[model samples]
Target: MDLLKTPAFAAHVESLLKEHHTPGVSIAIVHDDTFSSAAFGKSVISSDAGSEERDCTPDTLFDIASCSKSLTAAAVALLVEDDVNFPNVKWDSKMSDLLPEDFVLEKDEYTRDVTIEDILSHRSGLPSHDSVYMGTKAKRPDTAKSITRKLRHLPLAKPIRSSHMYCNLMFTVATHLIETLTDKTFSEFLQERIFAPLNLTSTFLQPSSVPPADRDSRLACGYSYRESTSTYHAIPVFDTPEDQGAGSIITSVNDYIVYVHALMTHAPPFTQAIQKALVTPRFALPEYNDDRERLQSSTLIGLGWEIFYYRGHRVVQHDGSISGLTSTHFFLPARNFAAVILCNGDAGYPAVAALVRELIDQTLGVEPSQRLDWPEIFTRGRGVRGEAESEDADGEQKNEEEKAPSSIDTAGAKDMAELTLADQPEKERGSEEKYIPPPFPTSDLPLDRFTGEYHHAGYDSFVVGVRASPEGGEALFIDAADRCMGFGIALEFVCRAEAGGDASSPSPSEVKFLAYLTDVDECETEILEAVFVVDGDDRTDAGGKIGKARRLGINLDEDIEGLIWFERV
Candidate 1:
């Protein structure tokens, strides 16, 4: 009887947290074995307006990002059920024989054929370069075996096991193969194997290992939504000690409903041959990454759960997003049922995926016009979710040229450099007179000989200087230190060598520039481009001039290919 203590399921989760400006959410369910929990608003919102808000309960805490890849695939299925300290570790072992110089990749036949079941079912052709671990701790820190040895300088976009790409660097190479076969520390082997054998006391692995008195009253505070001051700020608490096994854990929908009721009651270390080797079904998710009005379908991907199917039950889910939270986690196992919502702004994942599809259509009864309103299709247009449109049933508000073109809403952003330059307003960001300039009035060379430090072995270096231009001259910037999240990128120049060729050929010592990329408080940008090059007979010196800029190229993961060069430190 706990359909969220009804009142129409708590007014349809408070009208989807007032149609997604989302102050807070918490839900938990369980169904047949009966459990049911709920929470509603404010786990600290404060963009000033007299601060102090706090609420959101059922033991708050959060982060569950990338749903900590199903507890790092049940801690690598408890080291494949501990055959004496991973005796030849199984899930198809071979990560070049477990960690040969940290799982080398970019082909030695995909570093001798990838495994741990091809990085827990992501099929290992690795393409989530996720901007190479975003601002990599500003200068350089990374360890999950140095991000699995920067996957031997990245670049694979498909072919070793062929598909399902989703990589958070192969779960930080399964947190460096569970700290090289359990010598420990993937946060002390997930707090002594799965949060102390499932007691899950508010779970941890991050928020700086949460203790200082339940780290400020049972954790939770994460948010973001500025939309030119319609407020809701808050966002801090980002302590991903190097994404331990991809997306650091955190927890609390009363400790992830006892780790989703210990995988819907199989309990004790979820054993049935580690729950059929973590739900079997390996690849298949790409029919435009399936949703089909959410009945989901065969969808697949097992080890770190996804599974799919919905109306015909079978389910098993996972959803997570880091900075400024958003989680989901569901289960079904043919209806033993399980839920777990958790949301803290960044437009709270379309109200935590419409309260995990309205508590799986109220624990499978289904009807109400066959469910799926999902807050009226994610609040029908303000370009699909920054919201403003949805009104008419005679109440008006729709036509701003029939809306839908806005886009760029990187929900809760921040993979570094503070929640995209903290709560906005220094006269609307991007300063140094917003650099810009050089939209090709045609000038070659001399931009301080294309400045210094470039490198890129998996996105690591970035300097290139010269700034001041709001037309006072001298542009080309990019301090991408914390990568785009720290957004200083402005460059400009735009072409000298190959882009629609021969307008009188001869400008060849190579130049090209372009930049934009934007996240300086949004409005989508992404142009990028870069180039520079010289590399032969070192292009001039012995005093002939045009020197210093050796090699640079760019394409920061536009599904990688033909760029990324860097070198010239």
Candidate 2:
């Protein structure tokens, strides 16, 4: 007998989504060789009373986030299989040999010695170089190369292969390798190699690449929440074609399971040779990065998977989150079971993992979880995830903090630049004053001089451009593009300020600025701040460019003491 009746399971899923304020969810399961799928809730919902919203269906598209790495790893394995006669690509192949000849990691020799195996398991010693690929204005076509060129200057977070730090850029480099070795764009190669062979027409890297007509009907809307009102607002899908290998692939749970089944059965593209590499453990971490409560001493990471013990049972899986979406792909391969859970909301982050585990445990007749408690944990004032992560390790309490359908609720809910700006408020006939330019910019330093490309010894480059002040006159109109992780920053003002240090030696800095969500045009502002110090003559050029005009040191988080410094090219 099924542990959960179909109707009961659907009801439970809907309950979870509403309780946690996640609008939509999709789950697919392969139990003892039979395939099944369930979806519930609205793909799009509004805090606004009169707004149009939409429902999610079995075919709804989702931004699978880091789960894309599994597909990317599979692509690499196929290349290895295909290269039997040519320059053979092996797991132990040193990355120095694979990198484009022109690229150099000048100071980090340990990095050059990193093997293909290292990258697959997130052991490249590179921490997430978020500022590199996230906010930069660099053309998407040049992102991989620019990141490669800038990589030499970044210092490793840990000794190479010594520990796991969840570096996405390493995968970016791997995708670059795939492109170079195959002489094809990553997209083209993936289409010809993985998607076609698996007959997965719905899976793709970019949302824009999908037909507008089809996307309108199926793509699930992502969302974010504000604590004050406890309301959920829709977020747009990501615009991340630049970091394709790292985190941009989008697909539906239904389509994703087809790929999952192929891997399970060792189907075609995932041959026995590739399966060996795919399942073999590469790097091990102490505990699950996201879930601290579930302690797995032997958490070994595979080429594109995470192998850990759940209830003393071996389970292989991986989880991904960016902006509005969170997803997990997990299963007990030895038991011939697998499941995928995708939620389209930032608020859904913590619950996805738990739901996957509980469902599997109940199906397999294993010890059931005592309490999923997503609402008790993530609901506003109940101790949001951010608060939990920051809580004292000794134990304490705190709390705080999307998508589609099945028998669950289906909600109802567009483009690039217009969507990002949010509100799209038309100019009322009487408001000409809104267009007036401000006089005199903010900041004690010469603001015009900061515009240029800047490089950090251990991260990607940032381009500084000038814009008009949004709030008022006398504030500098400045926009600094972070090329590392595509984080959003809306230029507001530049000013002289100091934090820490006594009156005798106040640190010079720029005022706190707003970072926007890349996916949503009218994103809810989190009020995150960054403090940057500009330096000039004292900096040297490791970057191949000359006459660059800026030196910036930015502090992203308030609690951590680490500061990232960048020199103008």
Candidate 3:
């Protein structure tokens, strides 16, 4: 079949392999129900000439972490269709009702109240308290039970349906619910209903269950960065049967394409209901970057899929990341085009998404006016090369600096001039006083008193430390997992307290902390803020509960929050 190849495909394949420093990649393009798939580079790098790089093939199996969410969602759709009793199912179904009485969450109120829809939409009010899984010696069931038990004590960050917080626990709950509803495990339910019907024989819930030789033949080994060594190394894939609904699916690019096609076309029993669920925008994700254009429009998130605007068209997609593997599947329903890229390295998905958009546009002859020139945009525009010029320089150096900063400065100055003109003299500028700063209130507790280790049952371990600033007032720091995760200037804290406080009896010692970090190229800054509350309660014989504190909110300036919790040692 002589289907037109994208002009950028070869170049993109080569560039992605180089830019991400990946050893190998397997890519698939499905257009108009026809399929084309290929693998590039090598699966493994070798030190000796006798060893050859393993070639990625169409059948290369990847650990498609969250991509399995879509499959799980589809399976639920099938079950809903099979039995009218399904949608009537409530969020509060008991695991004991499905399995044994000792099953987890036997006593939690919230756990009893959570439903199937809530689980699918990730609105079960479950925070991503992942430490139980990461640090537990308990096998899958025990780990899952511990997580459910922990949820009984964990406070909800937001009201149910108030917002979307991507969490794995909700899906786990959904898996249990499905088992209860169908009297079958989630994997069995999926196999009997969705996978088997679609003829996706190569896809399955467990990786280890496959034959060792077959696993060696198709499995893509995962990888992660060694911060100390400044190199990449293999990372073990999480082995758990219970996580099948959450993150335990393994499939080849060809098999995943079948799933993506089913999604785009609404094939089989899923045709009506699945289509409705996939396009609905559950919540608005925070602005991805300062590129105001992308941030302004709300992207719709379906049960497990994210719908993005590309070339004025809605595209449904999702990316999966597990240890060393990253996979992206995006489909343009309007254009009848879809792309899947799977790699055995920690490659970023944004690039693959962009490339897929480009391929779809080229194939369909739909020109995208606002397409970002990526690596270049990251390099020259963001000053990622570290070749940015200083303010003071000689003639030759001045010219070099002027080449980049001059353009940015000109644009910024123009925007500032427009703002200034709009605010000018017809309004009596001198009469308008500058915004006055608020004064900090006197407090008896020394800064050191508030400086101590604090722990949240669900969130993570954090330390409140203070250092004397040259400006006189102390700089407060909140360290989580040895990383200086947050800080706040004294003035900012005082202002927040004054603006939003109990006027009669606000605690002067408690203040909010906001931390801002500049990107690697210093072209952008990201902020994460949290309210810091001091506890007056005394330590107990049991692990002392300092005063009650909650993460009131979080506004991450970046897409990747890295807001991980520490496990209890």
Q: TM-scores of the models, in the given order? A: 0.36, 0.75, 0.63
Query: Can you write out model 1's per-residue Cα lDDT over 1-569, one digit (the tens) per residue?
Result: 56677798778788778777878888777766767687888787654445466888878888877888877888888888888867788888888787887788877988888888788777777777666665334668566777788888888877866666667778778878888776877888787777788878888887778888887776777776755546655655656565677777888887788787786677887777887788888776543231323576746778888776767778777787654667878788777888888888766676676667777887788889878677666455223312101222111234544321244232212222233344343221222333122222225457777788887887788777775553465666665535423445656575555333233433335677765554433323445577887545545566555555778887766546678888877
* Ranking 1 against 2 by TM-score, winner: 2
Global lDDT of each candidate = 0.67, 0.61, 0.52
Give the range of the ten consecutive residues with the poorest summed lDDT in model 1.
386-395
Candidate numbers sorted by TM-score from highest down: 2, 3, 1
- Using lDDT, give the best candidate's number: 1
Best by TM-score: 2
Give the per-residue Cα lDDT of candidate 2 at 320: 80
Better of 2 and 3 by lDDT: 2
Candidate 2 TM-score to native = 0.75
